[model samples]
Target: MKTTRTAEGRVRAVIYVRISQDRSGAHLGVDRQREDCEALAERNGWEVVETYVDNDMSAYSGKPRKDYRRMLADLEDGTATVVIAWHTDRLHRSPTELEEYIDISERRGVTTHTCQAGPIDLATPSGRMVARMLGAVARHECEHKAERVARARLQKAKAGEWGGGIRPFGWGVPTGETATKFDKATGEEVEVPVLDLDKAVPEEAEALRVGADIILTDQSIHRWVRWLADKGFTSTQGNPIGHQAARDLLMRPRNAGIAVYRGEEIGKGSWEVVLDEPTFRAVVAILSDPSRRTTPGPEPKWFGSMIYRCGLDGCTETMICSRSGGANHPSYRCQTRHGGGRRGDKLDEYIEDLIIERLSRPDAHDLLLPGPGDVNVAALQAESEQIRRRLTDLAGLFGSGQITMAQFTEGSDMARAQLEGVNKQLGRAAVKDPLVPLVGAPDVRVAWKAMPLDQRRAVLRALMTVTVRPARRGRMPDGGYFDYETIEIGWKRSAQR
Candidate 1:
């Protein structure tokens, strides 16, 4: 190869190298390209001023290549009169990028050379045409490779195999005997992972199960966050599990042995189930409720803050917890300020005692619905599974070129809409009656105490409506105002004995 010299007497060159994937984190591919490029530069007597290498960076992914950008900057600054690479495809897999490179090279009077495809004079039309052609071929190969990879992944997902990523919590991949397969490329047998089945990580699985129960009972996700932190458990990234993380952890479909692809539930996975489907659905619904508060706010310290009603004349608004004028204790006052406040702690105690006494009755079991009422949980689950399978099949048809994109899109939209409706029904059905644990417990008081504030509040709201009537008389002997008579607990029709 003959190298052209600059007016200053020496030909300045820059070598650009890039490799798409480097699973070993070793730059062997780029290193080989760099070695070849250096040898070509040496043979041509071109002065190698810089070497730009973008390791594990794909030209087709449209991600920014830092070293490539730097090399371009150097070329623009007149630091190099020549650009060398292993091949024209190594320089660009995109036609638009090739055009830009051609424009820059033309303006800078810089020529490009490849160890394989030889020299490309950006200053001439023929050379630019050849570069564009090579770029187009590279783009075709990239798209083909992407299609093959997508199809392979979809097939794997359909087969209920692990799609491969960071291992999910509550599951462990065991070290088992490796299976060997004949490799056509190397003409030798290679050891492959037997079958990526994940077994239950006992402790993590138990934690997830407990989390599901807590979330299903309307407990705040913060409690689970605290539980995780106390248990010394962190996320796969080793970060302390926060409220959102806990919520997401409990909401994973994988916990229920359900596989998901691209945010859509596909079918059963190949992992051990950590949580039941109904419980998982219920927890997901609770955590994803739009009306649920996600902002930072104090948890309810009293059970009746929002459940108790302001029973003043013409003002039956819900009461809220409030502290008045440096009072040592907070009170439940009308949200609209229509009536006087009732001591929150006293009201909570009064309500809790009433609940314990009522649920302690022999007929407390009547409060629960007889076998899920009209929900048909099993049918809903089956229907949701069918819809998910339909969507997966539609995707397969589209990927395999059996259906046009338009047809696939329309079918998928309809199936997804159906799935959404069914999932919402599943979510609604997932709200197990909060009264189940308390109503039939051996000791209702102990069970009530063991229950979290949210669960207690849910039971209160469901069983009865407590109305805080106007205080009969102001201050009592202890300098506090709370009369049992002023607290009216009206049991709902569902709670009627």
Candidate 2:
């Protein structure tokens, strides 16, 4: 192949620049690297033919580096006689990548020049050894740096300090200033921000509290997203909130003043709490419950649909809402096509009245059963952690061929079943009781009416089991309607009728 050159026979050069992170998207780091590489090229009398950049990309991460690949293609086609970089480490942190680069350099008879490491001549054995050694040292430094950063983050979590990231939703924004403070444990000066933790942003904090209530009350996350949009609340990226974002906001452990590392709760956070611990845990349980409806299907339009039972002899199947006779004739029918169907409007009205009357009594609070407040949360969390560790170790053993397939399957199934139970317990504990608001209300009917249909259904399922029995055999008058006597309501709790 022919090597490209300029007037005066100067070697054609291509500069490659990269930075691991460009949080501001400003390319400032890559700009500095390019300037240094250009100076090196000028000093060597090499004509700069092209420049390639991979901004906010890490060579060690195994992610594709588009511009880097393009530059390699340019080199293979003999577009440039030499490649310039700020440093060898900037060019590669993986030994495999370095080896590939060396192979291309050898085939193309191209050489590498760095501003920091000087020239690396791939044509000579001694030069190749030096390049390999440099690559090894760079790889070691990257791995060691990763270990240090992980440890630092864990330490910060244990100390209840805010580790650096995007500003949390409710937290105050950083002013981009740093101050030095002497660390008591390390006995060294550490740079911290002058203004870091203050009271949470009032409006955002309020929004979080409202969100927690929405989840606790069994309202849809779709509702929460609409609420967030209505309040003009955007994410840290200033984008409108979506369903997942809305759920994430409610699920954040920090809202309950809890410190977490790698998704595990470490301790309390050194910040203001927007939600009480019990309430926060309950909301999490409700959202994470495996049985919770996530995929879209037919949503219940009536309170008794899919919940009330058919009290017909030998047919006690659950009932479902049907509009077979048209919208005006919507009714609840037994799932097994049992003898008769009940009008949806009449059944819903009777159930609503029964619930309000039961909750309106002076002793209504007694009907509320034991809630998540009685759960041993710490013990459950510990057991969950242990099961996870066991699962990880089991996988490792299986991967190494230390255990038979049968043994692995048995162990995994047993451990998973136990984990499932533990998760369900935790979820139950975290879910808030729907009856909390309606019970002991000054205006019970008014408060019940204010609740959404789903929450009202929750209260119904919690308080009583309704069964629609077959209509009594008798000749009815022309204008006669639904008989409340045919509906049997059994109280779930032991309370005075």
Candidate 3:
């Protein structure tokens, strides 16, 4: 390409390059842009002053680009008389930014040049009009590209194709036997990277198991993060996981081999589930519940004990865990109105015994309704599977050119909407009572004591209600005393056959 030299002087030129994705992995795109812009500067007899690069940041993303901002600052300071880029769009994909550039160029007497699109003569009316039109086109192309990418990702999600840099916990990247390949062009042997999951990370899987089984004792996400850290576990990025990130991982349906898209679980996924459906669902419930984040105080000594309120008329206060007779005696005491307290150990034992008897019945399952929705989980699963198969078939037909893009798009959208609706329904479906098995175990007492406080609390709450009253005055056994009327237990009337 022929070009004229700078008639004024050897003007200093600044070249800027940016790339959103580097498919070549060697940053060849930016390198090529720099080389071409250098050649353009050489042709104009301009001094190559500096080069600015903003890698992996899209010009249209609206995210602040450090290098791009620095270049603009340099321009404002009158450090550069000429700006060089591979193309106009390489510098900007937004028309507003293009306007800013135009204003800056006219004000600073800076000439903008592209290695490919030639010089942008801002002084003339025709040049400005052409520049504006090119900027408009670039902006239009960017919007369309974004729309296309979003649609493609949605389609990929529907197909249950995992797409992310960080791997989900409890999952292992597979390794395979490497095959030697002789590259004919390069005359070198290369080992192919394994693409299958034949290996498992035992430590990662174990960490997930420990977390899933933990009772909802610590409501804070930080508790789990600290726990995982103590276990010497970190995220795929090899950094300590944050509270929000840990919660996100624990709540994902993908851990249960359930397909999810855009914050909704579609159905069973293609990958093997690390956790069973019930346990996974339980984790999600505990983490997602807004009430799980109570006021940041001390952890509860007894789960569900706070539910006990003062039964005395006109003096209502939720009982709290407190210590009695030194550290040896922990009790639930009502701080409001001083309604007295009950020994935590004794209260828990009585409740557990009551629960054991209630659940040991022949018709114990008739008590609580699963959930309000009462959705048939099996039928939902089947219907979702059918929809997935239909989608696959429709995609195949489109790929073979048997169906138009419009037809395929319409069909896919309809199927996805249905799948999402069903997923919402499934999420509300009541899971089997986890405590029921323990209740029906060989030894109810052993099972009750062995259970986590949260699990025991769940059973105690479902079967009966406990009312804790103040101890009788002047009654003592070993520095503390509680009358028989202090603890009152009642079975729910609705629970009766």
Best by TM-score: 1
lDDT of each: 0.81, 0.83, 0.70
**In model 1, what lDDT does residue 131 have?**
85
Give one digit per residue, the lDDT tens place, for model 2 in 335-410.
8885767788888988898888888888998887677667888898778768866876786799899999999999
Range of the 10 consecutive residues with the lowest summed lDDT in candidate 1: 1-10
Query: What overall lDDT, based on C-alpha atoms, would model 1 receive against the true structure?
Result: 0.81
Candidate 3's C-alpha runs over 4 A off are: 1-9, 22-28, 170-193, 197-234, 239-247, 255-269, 273-298, 303-305, 312-317, 323-328, 335-346, 349-376, 383-430, 476-480, 493-497
Worst 10 residues of 3 by lDDT: 1-10
Instruction: Return the candidate ranking by TM-score, descending.
Output: 1, 2, 3
lDDT of 2 at 14: 97
- Write down the lDDT that model 3 would get: 0.70
Model 3 C-alpha lDDT per residue in residues 64-135, reported as the tens digit of each score = 889988988888887877889999989888877788888877877777899779888765677788899988
Off by over 4 Å in 2: 1-10, 173-195, 219-227, 296-301, 305-329, 333-342, 360-365, 371-432, 441-443, 467-490, 495-497
Per-residue lDDT tens digits for candidate 1, residues 1-497, read 23345566779899999998875565679999999999999899888888999999999988889999998888888888899999988878887788889999998888999999999999899988888888888999999999899878867776767888776788765577687766655766689665345788788889998787777775568777777888999886688888877877887888888887677777888778887777777787778888777784776667777668887885788788989979998988898886667777777887788888888999888876444466788999899888887987898899899999999999999998998787777766666777888877888899989987777788887789888888878676666666777777788746763
TM-score of each candidate structure, all chains considered together: 0.83, 0.75, 0.71
Question: After TM-score superposition, what is the CA distance of residue 404 in candidate 3 from its true location, in Å?
Answer: 22
